[model samples]
Target chain A: MPQQVTRLLIVFAVFIGMFLVAAAFLKPASFGEYGHYRGNAIKEIAAKEIKFVDRKSCANCHNDNSDALAGAEHALINCQTCHGPGYKHNQWFEQNKSRFMRQDPASGIWTVDTILVRAAKDIPEEYKLLKPNERDACLKCHAINAARREKVVRQIDVTDHYDVKKKCVECHPPHAPNS
Target chain B: MDPNYQHLYDALSKVEGYIYPNEIGLNWGILIVLYPYITGLVAGAFILASLNRVFKVKALRPIYEISLLTSFSFLCVATMPLIAHLGQPLRFYEMMITPHLTSAMAIFAFVYLWYLMAVLLLEIWFDYRKDMVIWSGEKKGVLRLIYKVLTLGVYDTSPKSVAVDERLGYIITVVGIPSAFLLHGYVGFIFGSLKANPWWSSVIMPVVFLFSAMVSGIALVLFIYMIISWIRKQKLDMKCLDSIGKFLFYILIFDFVLELLDTVHRVYTAEESFDIISILMTKLFFTLTIGQLLLGTFIPLLVLGYFQFSKPKDAIRKASYFIISILVLGGIFCMRWNVVIGGQLFSKSFMGFTTYKARLLGAEGLLSSIVIMIIPCLILAALLWLLPPWKKKNMEAY
Candidate 1:
């Protein structure tokens, strides 16, 4: 019995040792100075999600923007791009105090229309180039949000619905106050 | 269509039958589906091997090489489906080359390597080494060359060497048993981990997959064993096949019970996705439930059970076994299709469905899949020719 026990123990140890050696040898080959921690750190960054800003911050400047965006089913969208970087625009208008197209005298110099045109220009070309009547710009991101999307185009063609006809500005102004 | 589906149609109209974000394509679900099928083959083959090596079921001795060879063949083709399903198949080596050790998929890749090199190939070589020596001298031309290469330059045909080969092969077979389980069971874990997909989130998936694998494996071996015997004009081993049938009966029953239990649990709880799932059950899965579960699984089980216990004669029993085996294969395949493709048919919205049509040829087509499946059988045939498993000298001589 003692001999059997010792033999079993030795055999078990040998198996573990063999497994460990095989694992060590078969560790997959790698290249360059990008080793271990560095590689994992880079992977961690790559896996990091791209954040989308929320829509509430844009509403502070363009009070009626929300209502217009709501009509276009773009209530979920952030205003950074369409509003041409709200912080910088607001800062420039505040310092310059230009009264061009101002909706109110005491309010900053910029009016709703001037901001609308500027915001429209700053939009990415694909969204900006959408057919004026088509809801492509408004529908792209909002398509999955069916309830909101229905308020804007209501209906879309089969080919277009699956494609670019769904941009943000199709049914709403880039920067104008809501009607 | 149900009036409830009106809302679904309304939702579908907005996207115009397109997937959301463009990132979530058919690739993910397609890979998920193939995972179970491949793993099931592995499990089935291993179980067949176990019957001979572990349990010492003598009648199944004929199928001993075929089962190991089938497992090896299937493992070779298993990853092809996954590779075809990848958006970037070229970058797939990264899955193994630079594994995400934390991920279950990474662990699975390692497991695959372990089984391929350590389990299947080694055991198979050990089993066939004796035969390879015998054939190395007899054949000429391509067969001679093939035999020479396969023997790893070994010329030994001594009794002592054969005994050593048998002992080593036995040890490998014992080790391979768990590796086989891991191969299939991990697929279940993959689906079960996706908490976001309520359709897949369940602990029972792994257990169900394992048992279904056993059912499929046993049925497949029974089918092939009969065909091979018939082809060779060899005497049919009725007793051995009856034992196989009995095992298949138990596993198929276990699989059916688990599936029923899962459905009952889901229906009873009426989870958040229950409404949509019930609709799916009544609609898309109706054929699967009725045809596969009721007719395919249960009827075959009854037939197999009756034949095994009643002790029918060689001819009648053989015919019934063939029919039951075919039914078992069909039933298990339906189970896979339901678990895999069925889960993806419905949209995340739970209101709409999208269709998938497998192409006949080219990449991601039915033709390629068929070719992949056939390659293994061809390899096995070549192996049998080289090994000449039927000869008395090549036999285990228990």
Candidate 2:
């Protein structure tokens, strides 16, 4: 009888300990500051800030991209969220404008010519941030199957999509989005 | 593509050539089939054992011990399919440790445990205690040690102890009847309760499963009884053979009637899934109707019924029993195939049809099932070797 009682007591104590610990964790995790923010969309947005270049600046140069943005589902998404900042593009123009002046006039844009002509230069390899393999850059917001998103989509090795080998911008020209 | 043609083409194009459920291949269907097949064996074996214990049919006396051993053996292997089915096999203990009471699956774990430990294991232990004690005392080395552990310090082989064991065994046999029924019947209930699947959703499923379990159980015991008697060169138990044949006749009739009623109800209702199901019956599963139901169930019924009524000579009776046993076993396997594969044959969108082909040795395939089924028989063989039932001496060795 004593052994049975002792066993019962131990079981009871263990259950009580578990219940109290769960209560302690649950009250704060669910009802307190953390839980309060979990309900707030604004807080969630603020927590995951987008490193976006001002869209108005991109519009000054590329009006077609601005027009395409108005019709797309990704219109609400900021530009630099997909493509990194315009600071490097600005720097490239500054360095290559002299080379651009000597390009043939009958040929289309000097952007292509200048790249081919000045292909051999001391460009920092890291500054060319064209990663076609990273799907998280696009899937950050576009979740098709939300239930299994993390398990299925998030971990999908994106390099397998050979079409987007140079990143999403290959098909979706970021600066000149419509073209 | 034309609009109507495109829809048909798209559905056809989505069908994987040899693979199934394309996401996880054919594991799901394989698991579903094996789950009920193993459970049916448990239900059938238990019901066979119950005949001698509960119904007090003395002709079934030869099979009573074998039936108990069969039930116990089958019960041990029954959970292997479910474990193999699990996505995370190692986490199976969660079914016991922190079960979700609301889920049908969670309830099944408790139900299986109740049947295993409380009913099957307990009854087998009580029935075999006397024999185990004597075997233990006679054995010399490792077998003696194994027997000692199995006996669990209970050495009392007095008449009082024997009487107590017998009473407990009898009590367990009574309790096991409902547990045995629930073991397989609940599997039917699981399918029947799924209102979404038109093929599975019928009120008659549980009743069908229960009657069929009895049919298969009786047939299996009859098969084993004949085999064991042949091995020992002993005369076949005529009374036992007759009783089994009669019981098989009644249960098969009950099973056939219920199955017929289920099919009739489905056709009468003429629900949305009727056309595809009709195709399944006549076109896709023509063998199931002509081969399994007609040639297997109906003809065997006639054969067994004729033999039982005629009181045939020993050789004729034995031949009929063997044929009937084969037919009943084949019929039951086909029934499982119909339930598992037949339900899935209809398109989820209620559009068209699909086919199922069982793989031979995939991870969750026939190899696993064959291994699981054989393991129990191997265990039973070891058990028989340890304690030979036909020993001549009556010494209290323990």
CAPRI quality band, candidate 2 = incorrect
Interface Cα root-mean-square deviation for all models: 11.5, 13.4
Across residues A46-85, which tens digit of lDDT does each residue of candidate 1 receive? 8875333345534544566566677554455466544333
How well docked is model 2, in DockQ terms?
A: 0.06
Q: Which stretches of candidate 2 lie over 4 Å from their true place?
A: A1-179, B1-27, B387-398
Q: State the C-alpha lDDT per candidate.
A: 0.67, 0.69
- Tens digit per residue, CA lDDT, model 1, B175-253: 8888788778887888778776777889998888888888888887788778887888887777678878888888888
Total clashing pairs in model 2 = 1
Inter-residue clash pairs, candidate 2: A132-A167
Chain A TM per prediction: 0.32, 0.34
Q: Write the per-residue lDDT of candidate 2 for residues B1-398, one digit (tens) a residue.
A: 22533443444444532222322223256666767776787788788778888888877777777777766776787788888878898767656655566778778988998898778877877777777788789888998988877766577788877777778789988999988888889888888887878888888888888887777777777887777778768778788888888888888888889988888988899988887678767644554886568766999988877875687678888898887788887778777777877777665556555555667886577787778768877866665566554551331220
Residue B278, candidate 2: Cα error in Å is: 1.4
